[model samples]
Target: MQIGIPKEIKNNENRVAITPAGVINLVHAGQSVAVETRAGVVAGYSDQDYIDAGAIIVDAATAWGQDMVIKVKEPLASEYQYFRPGLILYTYLHLAANRPLTEALLASRVTAIGYETMIAPDGSLPLLTPMSQVAGRMAVQLGSQFLQTQYGGKGVLLGSVPGVAKCHVVIIGGGVVGLNAAKIALGMGAQVTVLDINPKILARIDDEFEGKVQTLFSDHQNLTLAVAAADLVIGAVLIPGAVAPKLVTAAMIRNMAPGSVVVDIPIDQGGIFETTTHATTFADPVYVVDGVIHYAVANIPGAVPKTATDALTAVTIPYAAKIGKLGVTDAAKADRMIFTGVNTYAGELTEQAVAESLNLPFHSLSTRL
Candidate 1:
């Protein structure tokens, strides 16, 4: 089997799909690996590192021309020309939000596997968890930075002074991202409140925080009030393969304090705030909307490339190896979880949620196989 590692070309996406150590593992498995020159450079892995691990250093075209291509983020428009029939693209394909990319994949007949949609038997997103943890933690850190008056914020300190009241932080969705955000916010001595649709998740959050953090049922009334009163609002909502539900409206943003900041971690999945027109890059991360600031960088973990690359490759290597050893279809036939990751298979939209979201016809994986 031949595997390719392409340099991530997304804005400020420094993390590569696989590390040098990951290349060593694939090489040990008797698989041929091709890495684009400088693909891992920004992630702290030198080209010699990959070469030493038995990977061929090649140009972008040669790397993308392999049987299977693993990448950190989805391919941008310029990279679309590399797509070909029967090529396997294993990456985070947020298809519900990017109709053009989805169409390109279908037209090229590429087998697109989305890391975020892959679910383990225990109903956990194994590949997506590590990056989610990074993003969740960074959400608070970035939100805090944007809350300063220098960054057009209200100058409310997150931790606050001994005599001043702590900042109020509201987090929407009590999932992995929300939980980590809450943990960091609470650690910083901020008043934290988390809202979610699942009562069990909220209960778990309540138990974990032990009354230090407030848990509320996520509803229109509660969400509106929470956002309005919050010094920082973290939109951490997710719907797996579907687009994120827009819970915060423009009116809600207008009602928030003039300097309040809203960080939408699920911007890759179409964002949880209605004001999120497009994803912002780290170069220009925030935008003002009705006097409220929005931090919706699609790739938050990319800010810490080394940590993110390590975290991503740790979980993705095994799956990538499996797909390399046995072809994508064969691997999918063996593991339903892997099958669940297939968004588009041989020109068919196999993921129902993505198809429904895009108003396309859905074809089950079993039928396609």
Candidate 2:
């Protein structure tokens, strides 16, 4: 089987789908790997590295002609037109919130396997967790930097000294993103409060931090109070491949203190706040929605390409190689977990979550398996 690795086309997304080591392993396993020119350059892997690993360098279309195509983000509008009937486009197709992209996949009849929707036996997102961790950590750094008056944030230091008040940060959701945000906020000496609907999450965090950070029961009233008092608000929530619940509303943002900072990580999935819409580039990642500073960079980890590329490759390589060797149909038939974006087997929504999210009829993969 031939596996294609394409350079990410998403704005400021420098991470590649695979690494030189990954290429080497796939080749050793009797699979052909094709990489586009400069695909791994931003990730610090030279084209020569892929060549040395026995991968053939090719253009985008030629690479996509392979049995399986691995990528970081969804294809652009133009690339969607290139989608053939039988090609397996394995990537992070965040389609639940992307109506247009989802429509294109269904029309093209491509066997799409979303990286973010791949769940392990433990019900954790194995492939998406690394990227979430990077995004989570960067959310704090970005929020902290943007909070300075110079960067358009309140003139408050995260770690306050004598005769100064500490920055108060309110983070929604206690999943991977929220936890990582809390770590950075606490490390910076800010007053951190993480709210979540799950008591299990709160209990675990309480035990982990030993009262270092506040864990609050998630409710509209508590959230409103927290946001009103917060110097920075980080929106980090996930509903699998579906759109994130709108936990933070425009009215809530209007009630916040002026000059307060908000970083909405779920903006890619339509956001957990009413104010945010997806931004195209890192150059202008925010807009004043409801008069609050919104930092809704969907590819938040793209800011640190070197670290993100290495981490992303670590989690996706094994799975990519498995599907590459076994073929998409066989892999999907064998392990149901690998069949996330089967929106159209021969042009039908094989995944129920995707169908419901997109308002399309759901068809079971078992019917065709």
For model 2, the stretches where C-alpha displacement exceeds 4 angstroms are 340-344
Give one digit per residue, the lDDT tens place, for model 2 in 199-314: 99999888878989899999999999999999899998998877778898788999987778899898877888887766546978777765578898888888888888788888
Task: Give the worst 10-residue stretch by lDDT in candidate 2.
Answer: 339-348
lDDT of 1: 0.94
Q: What clash pairs does model 1 have? A: none
Error of 2 at 55 (Å): 0.7
Q: TM-score each candidate.
A: 0.99, 0.97
Each model's Cα RMSD? 0.7, 1.4
- Relative to the unseen true structure, what is the C-alpha lDDT of residue 94 in candidate 1, on a scale of 0 to 100? 90
lDDT against true structure, model 2: 0.83
Residue by residue across 38-113, what tens digits does model 1's lDDT show?
9998899999999899999999999999999999999999999999999999999999999999999999999999
